[model samples]
Target: MTRLMDQEQENLWDSVQILSQINAEKAKAVFKVTIEKSLQQLGITVPVFSTIRLSVPSTDRLSQLRQIEKKMREAYAHQEKEKAYEYLVDYIERLSQMTEDDPLVVRKKLLASLLNERYKRKPKWSAKRYRLSASLSPLLSKQVAAAYYTTSEVAKKLGLSDQTIRRMCEKGKFPGAYKTDGGHWRIPRKIFITTPEQDERAEEALQQIDIKNQKAGYVDEFDL
Candidate 1:
């Protein structure tokens, strides 16, 4: 009996380590199976564990700004100059609203100002730039107010239904969870499970954003 318990404990620890390495979607599937098997092996009839809670620090709004910049890059790559300009203008507007003292935002705003000036000086550069910006004004105004995980995202990670996550949030089961001004539940990333790969991808994307920003003649303080 002692040996069996020891082996099960070891297996449980290994399973947790694996969970921390994989993406949330994949981890949910593995979590259910592993927990159940581990319990059965220990001769437990009832499930002992409920939800797997993992905490990661919350990312700033700059991450979303970086994502919008990537979309702009993709648009330009596809020769969608109109779409790219729309994304650029939207990106600038978001930067303007950010209250953080991030120096990167200042550099990006400068680059965007330069790009906007180029557009005015050379209308032939993108004939649809003004027209699309005007048409997309309403859409651009509907920005995501905060950086948070949706109920569905939390639900998948916790192996619960979306409704259940919503209920839990309402009952204050999740610390740091709150409803947006629009009345939608927003779960902070700090209370959410995150994988190392996700963090690596976010870091890579920020590095790319910085490189692109620097190419526009704004040098980083570190580079100086």
Candidate 2:
């Protein structure tokens, strides 16, 4: 990627030098004058400006900008709330420094509106993704958050039965668990840490599970 970028820059530099030389030669060959004067010198009657502003979006630049917009919207659609928020904030913040003639100026406003609306919804997201989604403010990433795991996965890691984890979550033991609309428990990876008292509670819970399972003619999943 670095090499490709360098090669592209080198080509652009070379092209710029060649074009600059050609333009310099042309400027020396033809003295600059008002368009009216030049037309008068050529015995023409049409009036024209001495300079004209050319505004066009290059193919690569346009494609890159569109790709960014696509990713931003996709993140939102996929429910990656944190990533979507960051993308929205970045694009909207960049809008002010951009010239009005920039190709994406209109898109900036459009995306800003769309993102701000979506951000205001404030979807219940995981720890790493708890963001201030309502504005184009600096991203405040949570200090310790990585990923979301299912209840089953968390149970396996903690050496507890799936039923035990689900029951605990349902009983409000794991407050960090977020249930989706479809009745699925999505637990944050950071929620497993226990206080000393909580650890004692967990031990007692497992012992109770052992007793209950033994009486029910089943095996408890306690590692001890």
The candidate that wins on TM-score is 1
**Backbone clash tally (model 2):** 0
Which portions of model 2 miss their true places by more than 4 Å?
1-146, 194-224
Error of 2 at 89 (Å): 44
Query: Per-residue CA lDDT of candidate 1, range 185-221, in tens?
Result: 7765543324334434433433443564577643232
Q: Model 1, poorest ten-residue lDDT window?
A: 42-51
* Model 2 whole-model lDDT (C-alpha atoms): 0.40
Task: Give all TM-scores, in the order shown.
Answer: 0.27, 0.23
lDDT of 2 by residue, 1-224 (tens): 22342343333333223223334322111111111121221112211111211222234533443355455555665788678657655644432233234535544544544445334453566532442233324433222213455777655444446886677678755445556544667665433322223334434444444465576643323222
In model 1, which regions exceed 4 Å deviation?
1-146, 193-224
